[model samples]
Target: MFEFCADPSTLETGPWFACYLTNGVHLLFYQSFLTVLLLLAITAPVALAFGFAGAAASRSHIAPLRWFGQVYTSMVRGVPDIVFFLFFVIALDQALEWINHQIRCPDWDEPIRQGANFTVCQAAKIPLSSSPQWVHEVYNFGVAVFTFAIVFGAFAANVLFGAMRAVPRAQLETAEAYGMTRRQSFWRVLVPQMWIYALPGLSNLWMILIKATPLLFLLGVEDIVYWARELGGSRTSQFAYPHPDWRLWYFLFLLVFYLAFTRVSEIVLARINTRLSRGQATMAGEAQRRAGA
Candidate 1:
């Protein structure tokens, strides 16, 4: 901020605006963009791993394991993702704290639930109520990221399970005839070929994930949406720079950001699909071979 910013009321238009945008709050606003990217970077792979596990479990020969996997994948699909996000963060947090409380304060006489209130001993509080402010923020962001991964993972599992099934039965048969075991055939033939079938659904899931990043605001993470609402609210004479409401512009920027993110993802995924299809027997692969020849 400029030295002239000392007297915000005395500053002229450009100077006030300049100082306003350069303030510490604006730096936090900019960092929120990185937070969004961080969330995406962490969640995507975690969700994919969860999906892979779910899909593998759903295909298990053991009846109980298969039933559990099938139920998890199916029930998640039947419910709205946001509902799970809202419920799970609190539920998981409470579950963790309760378990911690039992171990850390076993002698405490008070029940965790006192009528409408769910209270735990101070020692058991996540991040320890004594921890720094940033610790709490980081803890909340972790919860949000985990919640997003779990909910989206189930959907990914569904798409991947179907994709795994879509790989031709004849291909597996051919691999077996070539002296491959069932497991060998699955890894060598089915797994490699299923990706093209999965790409379209996975692409759709990526777009949804991009859009869902805004829901971080609901989860108490100080994401771009949080900053947009905070920075764009009308500022009166009480604040450093007085301004009318600018929330619409802030939200519009968010809209453009998400649109660009998804657009780039679509282009990248398309290129990947093309590369993956080059030597396969699928329609796209066959078309490419014909064109090249």
Candidate 2:
């Protein structure tokens, strides 16, 4: 960013290092860390919301809704997660583009699926072909985030569903005895108490989500993994900053990043668990009560 950085190639070793770190591409590489954070921030809540809905659906009095929830939760559990991540992003993208094609190119005569190729109208292309590179990156990242949320949501649903069931039946009965309807008992009694039981599963899911952030690169997002590969490869004489192969160091950085993330998540989740157990009937709650007394 300094005026001396006007000619990066001509700069001395110290100046070269300074300019290299301050270069526009390097800034983007750094911001990719924030992108990971943003994905996690958005995905966690969306996934949890989906989980709550799925868990509720599983216990619905209506047979079809219950079946839908049960199937969703169970199906994801048996499948490899990477398979779902790959399949969902492509499937969802094609599905959206296909729908757009039908609407945008109503007069087009070509079939969408001709052998291996899946063609859509120019107007139906996501972000359109004319859009900038960053737009394409963002579109891909959005798809990746949504896919991650959906797949993880199923696992979260299973955890939440079991946790909801684990809430003591007598608590619901007591609410009913006080003239509360089933729905009221669920909302006022059961839902409030299920968190203590759910915390452990949800905590594990959070760590998994943290580790999975790197998969954003696999989905074509220009995330840290993408940048690491780009910047870490040995630069030749043609590039201003020539360096030796550093993929090992790049991946090592990634490993440390994820480990740090998981550690932070564990500390935060533990604090949340303590807060949730403040007045509950679980072992943690009982311990807290004894300590307070």
Candidate 3:
């Protein structure tokens, strides 16, 4: 900002605009875009992994495992997403603090719940009461990531559960005839084949997940949405950088960001769908064969 405009007060028009846009706070605002992307990148695969485990557990011969998977997958279906977001973050925070209290302050005899306050020993507070600002930010980011995984993982499990069942029963029978144990055939055969059937539903899920990234604000993570509203709100002339209510423009930028992201994703997913279709008996495979001939 200094290189662009030595004194923002002295500058006008072009130089002033340049310096204002490149201000330190604006830079942090730009970096929040990366924060959103990183959360998506980290959360998507973890959610998928959890979903896979849930789907497999649902199919397990063990009764307790099957019940757990069913309950987990069903848990999110009837709840409003916004309500769940608010409820889970608070619930998870308290749950962690309680566990920490149990471990860190075992000798303390006071009940944690006293009237409206849920207090733990100072040592048991997440990030501790004395930890630095960055520690708090990191902890909040972690909770946001985990919250996203749990909710989306349940939806992914349902999609995968259906996809796994869609695989031809004859395929599994053929694997068993070759003396493959249920677990062996499951890993080598069913898992490989399930994706072809699952891709459509999973692709929709990926898009939904992309749209859902903005919910990080509700979880108290300083995400892109948070910064956008902060930076674009009305700024008084008393401030170094004064501006009107420019929130409309800020939101327009986010709109374009998400649009470009989804556009690229659709292209990539289409390519992957084509690749996965090879040698399968789906209509796409038939079309590919006809095209080659």
Candidate 4:
């Protein structure tokens, strides 16, 4: 935003390009990258927690709990991710609004489902219509995060369940031999060892999660993909900085960004795998031991 940028029309090539990139809209575009990063940061751990719960439930002695967990992982994993994304966000949104409507507008109840329209009272609207623009954006982003977590969580649960099973039965038996209860053995022996087995699957899930960030656009969060399309479109002379269609260039930048991000993720996961491999019986652990020797 140089002072000379005031007259975008008269500005030369360098100044025009500089001003174009530094404008308010471009700033928003830049901020959208952080939004994507934040989504990953929040969704990963939440999804992992969900996975752990589901995995544990699946392994539970109680039939109902085990069946519930099995159904959850099987159902969510069986569905196509995009279909789940679309259906779940709308369904979850309506469910929340329906709950709010019941609570806030109990007396004034015109049927919620009017052929195709799902109507709720004004007070029951999430974030409320009168809230700031940022409130709406935050709410939408939150919904996207939740939707991502649920879908990905099921896959993560499957990975974790397998990992939990892969832990040698002898280890648990040894814990029991030492007078540990089943729960104690699970926490002290099984949980600690499952990560090494889970890491590979979890790493793959991480990469998928990275790729999946673009789906935020489908959920109405104006993420990097949304901004890229918006900013990269051809602009007419009526606009401050007219340009031909540059979506190809914008998408190329995204391609580079994802490649770089995934590369770093690979490096990090490798290091973590090495760390987890130490003193374990896996091939990776054996390699580490030999290397150390």
Candidates, ranked, lDDT: 4, 3, 2, 1
**Whose TM-score is greatest here?**
4
> For model 3, what is the error of residue 144's alpha carbon versus the real structure, in angstroms, after optimal superposition?
0.7
**Which candidate has the top score in lDDT?**
4
Clashes of 3: 0
Expressed as tens digits, the lDDT of each residue in 1-293 for candidate 3 is 67747667778888888888898898988888888889989999999998999999999899999999999999875677779889999999999999999999999999899999999999899878789999998999999999889888998999999999999999999999999999999999999989988999989999999998888899878888888899899999888878899999999999999999999999999999999999888999899999999
Candidate 4 weakest ten by summed lDDT: 106-115
Off by over 4 Å in 3: 4-6
Q: Residue-wise lDDT of candidate 1 within 1-293, one digit each (tens)?
A: 77888887887888878888889999999999999999999999999888877887898788998998799899988888778877887889899999999999999998889998989999999989889999999999899888888888998999889999998898899999999998898788888888898888988988889888989987888889889999999989788677899999999998898888888998999999999898987899999999999
CA lDDT scores, all candidates in order: 0.89, 0.90, 0.91, 0.94
For every model shown, what is its TM-score relative to the native structure?
0.95, 0.95, 0.97, 0.98
Report each candidate's C-alpha RMSD, comma-separated, in the order given. Answer: 1.4, 1.5, 1.1, 0.8
| Collision count for each candidate, in order | 0, 0, 0, 0
- Mark the regions of model 2 whose C-alpha exceeds 4 Å error after superposition: none
Residue 111 of candidate 2: its Cα lDDT? 88
